[model samples]
Target: MTCRVLLADDHAVIRAGVRAMIQDIDDFTIVGEAEDGKETVEMARELEPDIILLDISMKKVSGLEALQALNRHSPECKVLILSMHTGPEVVLEALQKGAHGYLLKDAAAFELRLALEAVRRGDRYLSSAIVQPVIEQAVSKVNSNAEHTLTQRQLEILRLITRGESTRSIANGLGLSVKTVEAHRAQIMKRLQIHDVPGLVLYAVREGIISPDD
Candidate 1:
C-alpha cells in the first residue's frame, strides 16, 4: 500500500526538490505540501495524510511545535522530522515529543525512504549518524548530577513565557485559563530557580529553548 504524505518545508526550492525526489517512488504519494507550520497542521487535519515530512525550521510555528500538535490531534498520523540540525538534544526532544523519525537534512534520500518506511510500521527511526550521540546523551543525563525533569505542557509554557508572552496571550494561544497559565509560569520559574522575568528569558536562551532575537 502506498503512503500518502504531507510535505512541509519553508523553502520553495526544498519542497520542490523533495517532490521531485519522492514523487516517482511507487509507494509514496504527495497529498499536500505546506510552507509553514500552520499550513502544515491545516493540511494534516484536512488531508489526513498517512505521514507528514516536517522541516524543523519554518516561518511561524516551528516543525517541532507542529509535531506536538499532530501528536495530540491526529495520533495515528506519523511525523518524520527532516532537519539540518544535528544537536543530540534536538533529536532526543523531538523523539520524546512524539516524532516518529528524525533524519538530518543532509542524509541520503535512501535514508529518508528507510525512515518513512520504518515509522509507517509504528517503529521509531533515528539517523545512523546521530543514533550513538543521542543514546550517549540520554545515558549521560541519567548518570549526571543534574536532575532533568519537565512535562511536555510545562516545556510549552516555558517556551511561551520566556518569549515574553503575557499570561493571557499564552492562555489564549494554548487554550488554557489565564490563572492556569500563571500557575504554570510560577511552577516553571520555581523549578528553574529563576525569580526574575529577565532571568527566565536568559535561561531560556541559554538552554536553546528560545533565541536572543525571540
Candidate 2:
C-alpha cells in the first residue's frame, strides 16, 4: 500500500529535499506540504495522511505543539519528527508527546527511509546517532526500595513532571492546589531519590511509566 505523507517544515529547501527522497520510494507519496505547525495540524486533520514528516522548530505552533495537537485530534495519523536537535530531552519529549519516530536532519537519506518504514509498521524509531546517548541517559537506577512504594497518584504526578509540566500546570490540570502539587512532587523526588528533572525524566522513561508509544 502507498503511504500518504505530509511534509511540515519551515524551510522550503528541506521540504524539497524530503520530496525528492519520497519520490524515489514506490510506496510513499507526498500528499501536502506545510510551512508551519499550525498549517501542519490543519492539513493533517483535513488530509488524514498516513504519516507526517514534522520539523521541530516551525514557527507559530511549533512542531512539538503540533505533535500534541495531532495526538489529541488526529491520532490515527503517525508523526515522524525531523529535526536537527540531538538532545535527549527534545527526542524524549517528541516521543512522549506522540511522535512515532524521531529522525535527525543530519542522518543519511537511507535512514529517513528506515524511519518511515518503522513508523509505518507501528514501531517507534530513534535515529542511530542518538540512540546511544538516550540509552546512556536512561541507565540511571530508581531506588529499589521506593520503586514499588509509590502510590498511583504519585506516579501520575511523576508522569506530568517528566513530561515537562510545571507544578502549577499539573496542579491546575489535576484540580489540586499548587501547594499540594508541590508537596506531592517533593514526595515523589524523595521516594525516587532523584535529585533533578533530567534524572526524573530518565527514570520515568526507563520504568515505562511514561512512553512515546503510549
Candidate 3:
C-alpha cells in the first residue's frame, strides 16, 4: 500500500532533503508540506496523510504543540517527529504528546526509511542514535519508581512543594498543622534523596510527577 506523508518543517532546505530521502523509498509519497505547527495541523486534517515527518522547532507553533492538536483532531494520522534535538525530555514529551516516532535530523537517509516503515506498520520508532539515552532514562526512572513509592498525599504535597508552596501555606491549604506539613516535607526529601527544593523540583519534573508548566 502507498503511504502518504506530510512534511512539516520551517526550513525549505530541510524539507527538500527529507523529500529527497523519502523519494528513494518505494510506496511512499509526499502529499503536503507545512512550514509551521498551525499549518501542519491544518494540512494534516485536510490531507489525512498516513504519516507526518514533523520538526520540533517551528515559527508560529512548535512541533510539540502540533502533536497535541493532532492527538485530539487527527488520531489516525501517525506523527513522526523529525528534530535536531536529542534531549531525553524533548523525546519523552513528544511521545507523551502522541508522537508515533522520534527521529533525529542528523540520522542517515536509510534510518528515515526504517522509521517510516516502522510507523507505517503500526509500530513506534526511535532513532538508533537516541534509543540508548532514552532507554537509560527509562531504566533510571524504573529503578527509582518515584511515582509508585509516594502515596497520593505525598504526591500532592510534592507537587505543591515543587510549585514553590511554603509549608505554612501548604498546611493552611490542606488543613494540616504546620508541624505536620514540615514533617511531610522532610519525609518527601528523605524518600527521594533530594537535599534541596531545586533538586526536588528537578526530580519531580524528571519523574513526570509534574510538568514544567505545572
Candidate 4:
C-alpha cells in the first residue's frame, strides 16, 4: 500500500531537501506540503495523508500545536517530528502529545526511511543514537526501584525541567497555563526534595527520568 505523506516545515529548503530524499521511496508518496503549523493542520485534514513529517519550531503555531490539532481533527494521520533539537524534553513532549515517531534533522536517509516505515506499521520509532541508552537506563531504573512517589505527570514535568525547558514552554507544550506549570514545578521539587534546577536535573538523571545528555 502506498503511504501518503505531508511535509510541514517553515523552511522551503528543508521541505525541498526532504522531498528529494523521500521522492524515490517505493511505497511513500509526498501528497502535500505546508510551510507553517496552521497550514499543516489544514492540509492534514483536507489531504488526509497517512503521515505528517514536520519540524517542531514553526513560527506562528508550533509543530506541537499542529500535532494537537491533528489529534483532534485527523487522529488516523500519524505525526513524525523532524527537528534539530534533540533535547529529551522536546522528544518526550512530542511523544506525549501523540507523535508516532521522532527523528533528528541530521538523521541519515536510511534512518529516515526506517522511521517512516516503522510508524506506518503502527510502531513507534526514535533516533537510534538516543533510543538505546534511554530505554536501557529507564528499564534499569524501573527494575531497581519500581516504587516511586511521583505521579507520572509530575515525573514527566520533572523530566522536562531537567531537560532545560522553561516553565512557560512546558505550559505551552502541554496546553497548561504558566502558573499551573510553575505549581507543578514546585510540587515536583518538593516531592524530589530538590530545591534548585541543577539539583532537579541531577535527581532526574539519577532516577532515569531523563538521560544525562542534558
Candidate 5:
C-alpha cells in the first residue's frame, strides 16, 4: 500500500528536494506541502496523510506547536520530525509530543527512506548520526543515579508499556491482575517522576530499557 505523505517545511527548496527523493520510492506519495507551521497543521487536518515530514522551525507557528496540534486533531496520522537541531532536548520534546521519528537535516538521502519505512512499521527512528549521543545526553539529564530506583518487575512493565502493549495484554503476558499492572505502572511513573506515557517511553529509550524500534 502506498503511504500518503505531507511535506511541511518553511523552505521551498527543501520541500522540492524531499519530494524528489520520495517520488522515487514506490510506497510513498506526496499528497501536499505546507510552507509554515500553521499551514502544516491546517493541511495535515485536511489531508489526513499517513505520515507527515515536519520541520522544527517555521514561521507563525513552530513545529513543536504544530506537532501537539496534530496529536490532538489527527492522532492517527504519524509524524516524523525532520530538523537541523541535534540537541537532546529538541529530540526528546518531539518524541514526547508524539513524533514517530526524528531525522537530522544533514542525514543522507538513503536514511530518509529508512526512516520512513521504520516509522511506517509503527517503530520510532532517530537519525544514525545522532542517536547514540542523543540517548546518552537524554539519560544523563534524567538523572543517571535514578536507574536503581526501579525494581525488576517495574522495569519489565515499563518495557511492555513502551512496546505499546495494552494494560490487559501486559497483565496477561506477565500473569498479573490488571489492577496489579496498573498499580505497578503508577509506581514506575511516581518513582521516575514521569507523568505521561510518552514521557515514560522516552525515559525508557534513553535509559536503554527499550529500543525505539521495539
Candidate 6:
C-alpha cells in the first residue's frame, strides 16, 4: 500500500511542486494538504497520514511547534522538515524538537519520497549531502559540553539506529560507509558516556531529541 502523506507549507507553488514530484513515486500518495502549521496540525489529526511534510516558517505556528504538537496528538504520524534552512544548528534544533526527518526545500523529488518512506518505517531521514557538516557540528558541540551536544547528522543516525536500522542500512540510506556509520555511533556513545542501546535511548529522550512519543 502507498504511504499516505500530508503536506504543510505556506507557499502554494512549493507545495504544488512537491506534490508533482511525489506523484512520480509509486509508493507514496498525498492524502491531505495544509497551508500553515496550525492547519497542518488540524488536517493531520483528521487525515491521519502516515507522514507529514512541513515547512518551518509557516504563517501561524512554526513547523517546529507543529511537529511537536503532531507527535503529541498522534505519535504514529512521522514528520519531515522540508525547509530551505541548511544550517547545522537549524536542522539539529528541528530534530531535537521532534521532527523525524529533515530535508532541504530544494531537494529532489526522489529524496522527498525517500524521506517519507524512511520516517514511515520508523526510521529517520536526512539529506545525505548535509550530513558531514552536521556531524562536525555535533562533534564540536560534544567537545564543548553544550547543553544538547548533538549535531544534526549524529542525531539523524542515532535516531535511525535507535529506531532499529542496522549499521549497513544506515550507511546505505545516508550514503556513507558501514565503517563510517559505526565510527559515528561509537563516537556518539563515547561522548555521551552511554554504554548501550537502552542508555542511548534514555539520553536521547532526556536531552529532548527523539521522544517515546515519537
TM-score top scorer: 5
Q: Model 6: per-residue lDDT, tens digit, 1-214?
A: 8889999999999999999998998888999889998999899889999888889999979888898888799788888899998898887778777787789988887787778777777666778776655555654555334354767889999888766586888999999998999889998888877655544655665566765544
Provide the global lDDT of candidate 2 against the true structure.
0.84
Q: Candidate 1: which pairs clash?
A: none
Tens-place lDDT digits, model 3, residues 117-208 = 98887656778777657645644554454453787889999988766566777899999998998888889888877655545656776788
Q: Model 1 over residues 26-128: C-alpha lDDT tens digits? A: 6998899999998999888899999999998999999989988898888888898989898988987787777877888887778878887777766567788
After superposition, candidate 6 runs with Cα above 4 Å error: 143-214
TM-score of each: 0.66, 0.68, 0.67, 0.65, 0.74, 0.70
lDDT of 5: 0.86
Candidate 5, residue 65: how far the Cα is off, in Å = 1.2
**Candidate 5 per-residue C-alpha lDDT over 106-182 given as tens digits, one digit per residue, 9 for 90 to 100:** 87778999989877877678887776666666656665565546989999999988766668888999999999999
Q: lDDT per prediction?
A: 0.79, 0.84, 0.84, 0.81, 0.86, 0.80
Model 5 vs. true fold: TM: 0.74
Highest lDDT against the true fold, candidate: 5
List RMSD in Å for every model shown: 13.0, 10.8, 13.6, 11.8, 4.7, 8.9
Off by over 4 Å in 1: 143-214
| CA-RMSD of model 2 | 10.8
lDDT (Cα, 0-100) at 112 in candidate 3? 93
Candidate 4, residues 17-63: lDDT per residue as tens digits?
89998987779999999989999999998999999998999989999
Model 6 local distance difference test score = 0.80
Better lDDT candidate (2, 5): 5
User: Distance from true position, residue 176, model 4, in Å?
Assistant: 42
Task: Write down the lDDT that model 4 would get.
Answer: 0.81
